[model samples]
Target: MQSSSSYPEAVEQLIAGFRRLPGVGARTAERLALAVLRWTPEELHDFGLLLATLPERVGECRVCGNLAEDDLCPVCRDPARDQSIICVVENADQVPVIERSGGHRGLYHVLGGRIVPLDGIGPEDLRIGELRARLDSGEVRELVLATGSDIEGEATATYLARELRRPGLAITRIATGIPVGADLAFADSATLATALNSRRPVG
Candidate 1:
């Protein structure tokens, strides 16, 4: 489809690329492209280099599914962590929020995403197999579900809690004190701390 702008193809292409970003709109993307035009040659080169190298610079943690430069995330690599308790979150971004809460000293498991049947995303679509593999080691005694409070999140947590029951495994869900449908990734540290502290075992 033809762009709505009268700019040269290069500028339009740049705007189109920016528009593909998560929250960027057509106007915002155009503005961003214009802003980039004002950057110095060195700045432009640096930005291009960073964008080009992003894929190689970041990769999934083999142990936890979190973003990592190496095979293991920092939490997994640290010997001081409590390996007996695994906090499961919907995405890698939620890991930092919980870490900042200072409530959990255990390892994390990033599910990559929650189960949303409407979106055709199931347990197999996420990193659930990896999480199960981690638990099979018998090191994890507690599985804390830290998914969001939304419908999909609640459903996902419920499914996991029911499916992962085993002897010696204590599965729990983070407290629902946070507003309903709230995303855990953007929750305040104090709230996250409270949720983690008040987590109750799944019946």
Candidate 2:
């Protein structure tokens, strides 16, 4: 059978590449390919080099599980940040969302994902062990649970709140701003800020 596309093989290949990325549909992929085609050879070379080196340059933060170029993430290296409080989030993506809000000056811990029983993911599948190790160091006084408002997120938060209870630790949950069933990855900075600022003690 003959192929359906009329475009050159290279252009089709570029569009396919863009389509592999999350949320890039056929139209968007075409637009991206066209845009890339307009770039100078030197610009294209630079872009290719960046993509080639991305894997070597980026790795998970040793302390917080956020993406990092070195052994620790930028937040872990900053001594000025509040060391006594740690905001726990569901994923590294949510770290930036909360950061953009300019709320919660404390450091963060990325759980990697929430607990979903139906999906067969439990607390053991996440970074809960690493979190426990951090808490054991005796520096953190408060833990701000910033997981999503969804069911799985709620289960994970509740699990952590129950498991991590101990002397002098004040565990708090983000308050009313984020709507139920909403993912922190898609939440606006303003809403995140409100949620963080209004955090209440978790029972």
lDDT of 2 by residue, 107-197 (tens): 9998988898898988899999999999999999999998877777788889999999999999999986675443667788888898899
Model 1 TM-score relative to the real fold? 0.82
Best by lDDT: 2
Residue pair clashes in candidate 2:
none
Q: Candidate 1 on 1-203: residue-level lDDT in tens?
A: 24446898899889989989988998888889999999999999999999899999889999999889888888999999999999988888888888999999999998888898988998899888888898899999999998888788889999999888889999999998654443665678898799999999984
Please name the candidate that would achieve the greatest TM-score relative to the true structure: 2
After aligning candidate 1 to the native by TM-score, how far in Å is the CA of 182 from where it should be?
7.6
